[model samples]
Target: MHRAERPVLEVADIFRVHGPAWRQTVQLSLGQLKVMSAIEQCRSAALGGHVLRCSGCSRTEIAYNSCRNRHCPKCQASAAHRWLEARQADLLPGEYYHVVFTLPAVISAIAWYNKAVLYGLLFDIAADTLRTIAADPRHLGAQIGATLVLHTWGSALTHHPHVHGIVSGGGLTSDGERWVACRPGFFLPVRVLSRPFRRRFLEELAALHRRGQLRFFGEYAALADPAVFARWLAPLRVCEWVVYAKRPFAGPEAVLAYLSRYTHRVAISNQRLVALDERGVTFRWKDYRAKGRTRYKTMTLGADEFMRRFLLHVLPSGFHRIRHYGLLANPVRRHNLAKIRGLLHATATGAQAAAANAPPGNLPPRFICRHCGAPMVIIDILQRSAPIRAPPAQRAAA
Candidate 1:
């Protein structure tokens, strides 16, 4: 389902009314307001952009430029292409894995208030846990690279903060000699990873508390006290933290396909939106837990309630949603990727190398104007504005 369209349809009324009141409200943060404005004006003429016309038939087509913000649904296709291009050269000749590290509702509550700190903590703990475990002699005994993305919402647009990790199946040995691979069907012990992640996260939280770095208010006020913080963490120690690992992908191609679909996905899509009537907003969502989960279900929610749920996922300013760790670390990524490729090339060749190094395939051609059959150019861009006016006609000789 194209969940990206839901917001544009559902929030039409809210944009019509409270859109001007943005300057007055403090609870509605700048990020939220910016998203609201984008939702209202996206695909409309309020922001100048472009329009297309067919030369042969003289049929004018209206098209708008996307904000291209990572959070914007319409912009993700191009974003995914660019990201895949950058990573093409870095692909290793081996299996890849999809791992997810989820924060419990308890921590999610605190994260709602202190997003920057807590979200950073979540990434650090998850990455550090994987790195530490992989380096252990009992495990893979190699340093790995992981691409981590932070997602704060679930399929139904609920607040469920989690980090999704796309990890290269193997890694270079500590001395950068050989590419070490993992056993089939297993990556790391989930129990071990969960325990360490929980411990490391709590340790950092404790440090933040001692340094007076964490702000506690609303339901999280009790965490301000040291004793209360300890008690809050105690329950978490015994409960099993979920660290899900899907079966390894065939190679980097499969991994990139998964990333293209999952990465940059917003809470909802435009196509899934059915209507925005007095019954509130209606949209479709997937039930991931159910078998044959391909079926989509419709949900109706009040406008105010829908807005609240949507705003819950707006991140703090300048916060990065995607991050890299270990060999994929920014400073040494190019050098490390080159070395890794050299090693992989020594072992593998032909189709594998071509797949790893080649650029993504071309996009299909667009429809041409019927009259002149000339490729039309976008003349003006419009977002949520009045219907486009017809282009002026040229009179033929009688």
Candidate 2:
């Protein structure tokens, strides 16, 4: 006989249990609290839902609606799927490179206090670094396109701010009449990319400081002084900044697959939660320093600490986490892509052709029956349940 599978543990479960007690103990921003509330109520009656019946088997079930909060781990999968579907038409028939620009620990600490300004600089500078370097005569010397995604958390849910860029292998010539491609398997040198990225970022950061745009709090409050801030930045100038470029993707499909993993990732996933109990919240994390099988490890953090780390990555409201630059910039993207295809003598791929032939506004149905493999039709609309005014009392004594 087959053994029954255990149900998965989710972040929402932890929030529902411990959040009230934790909230009384520490301060949280409006945005962070909103994220917590959204996670706690996601896909539950709190958000309302619909009743579905299978066309084939007559099976019926109540399907609660997702919170649709971008930061919610449970909500990003469908968001990523929809995003990838839209991006399919933009795929070019060439190599694509994955480049990452990571901020050092010192900067990350400051970023925690001044998120909007600092994180915005990170995105703008990283994209500029790629476009500027790629435009050089010694480098590719072409105007390329890129899609950059900002991920603020490490595997252990630590605040590790970085931008992952998916860049096309080639670009249009100066006159916009020809196509230029990079050498196979190689993009730009990381060492070359790193120095400018560091310099440009620091310069812009200093400018922000001079303009009094950056903020500070707690132990970092001394950074409000220009002299103290200058001294703090001194060490970072000499330290090496990290700019990493992975090998070119095998094909467009591989690029999309890789993007699916990175683009919509949250601080933690539901699958990684191994246990939650008196000891704390236990989860699996990857140690990049370890080799082979040893790299994977499980870690436990006290419920309060775990919630602190999770909330550390809550972004400012209305910040765009994913961005485009150069030829892929939204305004000129379509025109530039048409020009590049013509120069390369390239025809639309089968996927692109199908996308074009598809009827306008024709979207696939979302819900389906698991048992009967048929479309799930909505039979009843369920109004949202009243919001929980307070998280339940702590379950520590249980």
Candidate 3:
């Protein structure tokens, strides 16, 4: 007999059961606490939502509204789609590179505590590295455009911080006269990027340190002393700061597929969650260190530990995870794009084509009846179903 399909598991299932206890034991930032609360209530009757009816069968169902919080697992796919469509016009005519810049483990230790300052500096320095290397006469020497998305978690939900950049493979000449494409398969030399990136980042870090802008805490408190901090950074200069550029994407479609996935990815998705019971939470994660079959393994962590790993990724409030730079920077993208388009229009082959992105102001029905496979429409409204209340034990722990 065919095996029965396992019921879908969500982050909320674990959060609802253990969030209060976890919160009481561990001191959490307001942003992390808010994220936990939102995830727990997302799509639950506790948050008011509407009743929906299938148009064909008239089968009614209560569809609770989503919290629409960025970190919530259920909310990002639509958000990524809409964001991709809205920025579709930003696509350059040629191939794009998926470049990734990762912070070393030592820096990540500092980054965990000084998130806003360090993360922002990471973006700025990464962007500067790309633009600088690309603009050198020996290299591409043209002003390229890039869309950078910040990701803070590794597959195992560890605090491995990195930036994913979707960059145009080519760029415009200084005078805005023509497009300059890089060597066919390669975007930029990885070794070249690594050295400069490390140098620039360290300089920025030292500057931040010198200016008394960086804060150290707990065990890292010794880094508050400039001498100790400088000593801490000395080894980083010689180490290989990972700056890798993947092969160029085939075309615009590949770029869109990539953006759709990475731009809004949370630390973990619901689909990866296998079960949450007395044993603990079991989730599928890729062990990048292992080979083939050994790579895909399920890890079971205690509720407290799982929640701790999840909270490690909660970003500082109001920090923009997705950013644009170079020709794609907000201030001058329109004019710069027009210039690029003009250069494309002067094409010798007349092959380059233009496309406009038209995003719908209102979204169509997303939910469908499992029984009927027909679209479900909202038929009625409902109020909050239950208030999230902490237990006496949890309150005492708090």
Candidate 4:
């Protein structure tokens, strides 16, 4: 039986080849080390797998298991599919808006050192900003639901912290009596959202500092002083915080398509990597500042530098990257959805509602024959193999 070809290159390959040497030059946290190890072993014999035989041609092969680490670039596709299936029921027939709130570079630098506190604040404050603006009489003037996702890397893997929010275009009235819709193709104004978002975030950030919840290091070590911290924040108060809303989605289907791409993304995907060699790791990146064709381009970075940039986004241990707020909050989501559906005259339940909103596509089965295009069935299970040990030199450095 013929086995399928693996990608010419993957993050896993880079990690296995260069990670040991890189670990020697820098201090990595336990969590970071674990992530590197996971990527290196994913979908290899080290994890063990199962024997599968094709029903059509009697061809057999071994299928290894994935590491399933949330941070692994190799594993997010299936994760995203499963997540989208659950979210099908949450879709509303009304228009949906995509909103992004970004912290300036100055704040992002400190955020690198205080991810849990600062990132958590980013999610909470961004959600609060949307609800506050939507509830204002001048805006949509209702209680809207939103799903917010935090992304810490830019196209080039820089430490750019931002939250992408998917908000229902309208909301239920303050008394929960009826549905209210915003003007066609329009959501809340970005200028209005920016001011309050900026104010509340800085206010909350100062509070965290006052309580000694934030950390500073190296060049920023002076920020530990309360007076020094205030001075550092002075410029941020006057700066225009980046908050913008894209046009309303084409329909519920479009929103699902968007969610599928964004919800489970890593710092980089295997598909984007073009090559790896003595020159460096080459990959595609978009330059948002440029217009048209000029926006798309490739970048090359030394393998060591690439790995460092990728690990910068590992996240604090157990931090939740995706969150729901306002009407979409988990505890009340089902009840709130049922009520909204009633108002919209589409009060279907369970399988019926999910069917109506589900995106059109058939997810492939877990195993398929590489030779004859037939489904494969497992014939035997293989237990995990013994763990591999690092070289003595590498062990000492790590």
Candidate 5:
């Protein structure tokens, strides 16, 4: 059984109440609650699905259906596969890089109030920054393709909003006659990208304020004043917004692996929930900046506090976390991908063509019965609360 399937009253059980409470209170965010609930219900009868039985012994078992929501940590494997399959044809014969653009604490606070608007602004600004920088004569001088995903929480479930980007390391020149590749290991100057991102984001934010599209409340009420809002944004002018570019991925396969791991992750995984008691919840987290490979650290917080942290990540309803830009943009993606594939084929020779046509890695094997060590077959489907009849006992002799 998965960690989440264990008994209900264990220390880990704190997450159930804590996660939901936080979301309901709006102290924690909605995204966290949906993800937590999905994790708890995964492979369980609440979803009402069939289970596998032993073909030889006729041993029965129960299987639960999945929520299949995109953000569900337990449900993204198949979803990612489907997405990657569609994106396969868009691959160009070139390297890819990962870029992250992080909003400052000041902006993050504002974003906590105006989530959908500001989050959408972040995507547009960052994407525009990359496209504009790449198209500049001094840069790659081409139209780049990028995939952007929004991540709203830090490892500890703190409300730190950021955007993760997967970008082609090169792009087609404006004329489309030839491809313009970036430096083998470098995509763009972080400083340049950061500056443009801040500018575009602030410009749009100002426009929104002017149009009376932003709402301020509680401690943020001061932002409703134009002068105060402008003053509040002043510090960001000199502050360096973080723009990180990691080394190029090993290949397309590596990129997919990264996405599978990071894309669907929730506020906290079941494995991370160590114990729950009167002392609150104990959980593990990674301190990314620490050296000596001292990766895992444990934290304990009050149940209410834990819930508060977890719910701070819920996204607005109907908001999309993943987005495409440039050549991958929906309007012209089909045409762009076809053209790129043709270019790749023209460049690939005999051996490369053969390798490209090779089948991908096989799927992981399905769950099997431990008693007989054989593949289990499904014989019946059951929904929750479905009744079953028990056999009558034999009559006693006089």
Candidate 6:
């Protein structure tokens, strides 16, 4: 007898069956456990959903609900699209820069343990570094704005923390009266950005350590010693930290398109996932150090190991990975946006400004049926895996 071909696999498939076993071997943090549960249930019938009936063809389909967890691989695209649409108004009619700040190996080790404390510091310090360097008279001497997104995993699912920042190539002058543009082809010097970035991050990290705010576990427990931590950070102080700024973007549209790719990204998208079976979980990963075909490689880890690596990226609860800074800071973004537009005399993007200012629920529905090209009405709603009911004891008592 011949066997039929196997069905294509999904991350959910792998996680659902193997995740529990992996959890048995390790004591996962509440955040990690929650992330695992979300990824496993994402887009499945277990969660509530709605029925969409196409009026044109009289075709009806059941759409499963999204888990909406930031780490869910299946849900980030929609989030990114909505954000890009909103960003239509945030665009400044000038060159924008793609800058990335990476943590060094020594500090990255600490970040692996004390993720919340160190990662938060990284975001703040990186933003402050950009603003401080930009404000110097020797540079643009203007207050810049940035959209910062933190990415905590490497291509192979390792814990490599970094921030990808989208920065305006120009900004408002100190008096907020005029826009100050950088040189046509360049933003601030990477060297200038790197020094302050390294200084500020290290300073804040040390302070956190001194206050015992940082955690060290397993092999890193010795780092809790201030002297040992100081020695570990010493090499980083003099060595050049990685702060790279690409050439200025062609225009604002290109900036938005570029940012949409990075802003809502999770560890690995579904497209990159290849197969999972008795052999293990195999996926494609890019080796940035290599050239051409050699750069692309497939890695297969045992099911348990794969889950462990995936869980490494589970963020602490309520941590905001994407943030606005300086002139783009949430509180002053609108007023400052108006000021910059006034100085530049650029045309408004669309009704985006109005749409953004409108109350959340006041906006119309964003979802529409693809088949009929019409608005989808919720004909029915599904519930979660658990049915809505009291236990037998409660029913008996009543």
Which residue segments of model 6 deviate by more than 4 Å?
A: 1-7, 351-354, 357-367, 387-398
> For residues 167-283, could you state the per-residue lDDT of candidate 2 as single tens digits?
999988788988889999999999999999999999999999999999888899999999999999999899999999999999999999998998888999888999999999999
TM-score of each: 0.83, 0.95, 0.90, 0.92, 0.82, 0.91
Q: Residues 53-166, candidate 4: write the lDDT tens digits.
A: 889999988888888888998888878877887888888887999999999999999999999999999999999999999999888889999999999999999999999999
Clashing pairs in 4: none
What digit string (tens of lDDT, one per residue) describes model 3 on residues 260-302? 9999999999889998889899999999999989999999999
Q: Give the number of the best model, judged by TM-score.
A: 2
Between candidates 3 and 4, the one scoring higher on lDDT is 4
Q: Write the per-residue lDDT of candidate 5 for residues 235-311, one digit (tens) a residue.
A: 88888889999999998778877887666666666567777878988888888888665977899989888766765
What is the Cα-based lDDT of residue 264 in candidate 1? 75
- Candidate 1 off by > 4 Å: 1-26, 51-60, 288-296, 346-375, 378-398
Supply the global lDDT for candidate 4.
0.90
Model 1 clash number: 28
The regions of model 4 sitting more than 4 angstroms off are 1-5, 347-365, 370-374, 386-398
User: lDDT by residue for model 6 over 353-381, one digit each (tens)?
Assistant: 77567677775554456655666566878
Return the lDDT, model 4, position 89: 85
Model 2 misplacement above 4 A: 1-7, 387-398
**Which candidate comes out best when scored by lDDT?**
4
Better of 2 and 3 by TM-score: 2
**Cα-based RMSD of the predictions, in order?**
8.9, 4.4, 4.4, 3.7, 8.8, 5.6
Look at candidate 6 and give me any clashing residue pairs.
none
Superposed by TM-score, candidate 3 places the C-alpha of residue 367 at a distance from the truth, in angstroms, of 5.3
- How many clashing residue pairs are found in candidate 4? 0
lDDT measured at residue 21 in model 3 versus the true structure, 0 to 100: 70
Q: Cα deviation in Å at residue 35, candidate 2?
A: 0.8
